[model samples]
Target: MTGVSRLDDPMPDSPSQTTPIPPVDGVLTMFYYNDLQAAADWYHRVLGFEKILIAEGLVLFRIHEGSQLALVGKGYGSQQPLAGTNKGAILSIQTRALQQWHERIASHEAEGIGHELHRGGNGRTVEFKVRDPEGYTIEFFEWVE
Candidate 1:
């Protein structure tokens, strides 16, 4: 208790207790896959994400400082992957090294990685999209000044 705050302390009604709570410390987006290990390996090899943790049916990769990507095996979670294209969503990551990432992903011969890197219509970002082994779209972009 030396360096920690306790709710049971004398200041039970302190502002900290009444506040809406602190800002979100991090974010993790989950993608369901029938082949979890294959998806995990694809993310690691294609994107070069670092594996921060792994479990029975889930593997977490750190995208950056506070963002993570979670790959969940089918039947392990509430959601299961669809038999066809899972176009429900896309994961877009903002980075300053877009070209570097483009080069790395291109070398892997990943599907959809052949798309040319182009600037946004708004002229604010340069980006390209690549499909993971499971057909998940992962977009990498860099904001322009």
Candidate 2:
């Protein structure tokens, strides 16, 4: 992680003299849930995401080598869970084993909300969407080559 700069820091005389910004090493996407444990179980059982860290009202899962997914419980995050519909965001995962993933998720019909694999626009990729316990969409896709 990079150090935070203060607002009162001296300004650079020119662009070349400005402090360099550090490179981003990884990314983390946080999702809020009312029932945190239930959501965590669903993600583990269906998607096989391994939990890296667990804390009070927070759970982090390793999505890949460089990215992670954080699940924040109610009252711990800025926004509460949507009452019925998940409208704003979709958690998308890109993979090369499209059919395999579809089959794996399809087997867990009780927990997996939807499993309709189809071609994306312009025939560039094939994808499918599944809803988590809290109605958040998780899309898996594979780029066509």
Candidate 3:
């Protein structure tokens, strides 16, 4: 045989390569509601979220620093059990001022209709749950430690 290297042989001096992963900046939570306008208004009033963008049947809001809350119009075949109910899925909001956050949510008359406050898993966070007009539950909390 001739003194030549095989074509299918792996290279010994080449470094291993890896695929680059994309960085996650933040999360955008989507909630489906039958009445998009009503749901948007309710979230705006309750969570102090301002409308960032409004499309055909969707409304996007900037809830906090890096988080976004999107309200999608229902009846587009994306229905879930929690779509028109307020008992499923817990949306959490993290804050630095627990007491102030609690006070602000507690002071709302609309919150009094369905808002409940409790201690978190570690006992270092205070959480409050409230429902929007479309019957979607949202949980807001602040870290005490």
Maximum-lDDT candidate: 1
Ranking according to lDDT, highest score first: 1, 2, 3
Which residue pairs overlap in candidate 3's backbone? none
- Candidate 2 local lDDT, 1-145, one digit each (tens): 1363333565558463566667989989888999999999988999999999999999999999989999999999777777654548878899988888888988988454355778874566689888888888888888766
The candidate, 1 or 2, that scores higher on TM-score is 1
Cα error, residue 40 of model 1, in Å, equals 0.7
lDDT of 3 at 20: 43
Give me the runs in candidate 1 sitting further than 4 Å from their true place.
Answer: 1-21
> What would the per-residue lDDT of candidate 3 be over residues 1-145, giving only the tens digit for each residue?
2453344554455443244457879888887777788878877876678899999878899977778988888664365425445445657777666556556656666543334567875576677766667566666677554
Backbone clash total, candidate 1: 0
Better lDDT candidate (1, 2): 1
Q: Model 2 scores what on Cα lDDT? A: 0.83
Give the least accurate 10-residue stretch of model 2, judged by summed lDDT: 1-10
How close is every model to the real structure, measured as TM-score? 0.80, 0.79, 0.69
lDDT (10s digit) by residue, model 1, range 58-139: 9999998899999999888888886655669889998888888889998888898755789873666789988888888998
For candidate 3, give the lDDT of residue 77: 34
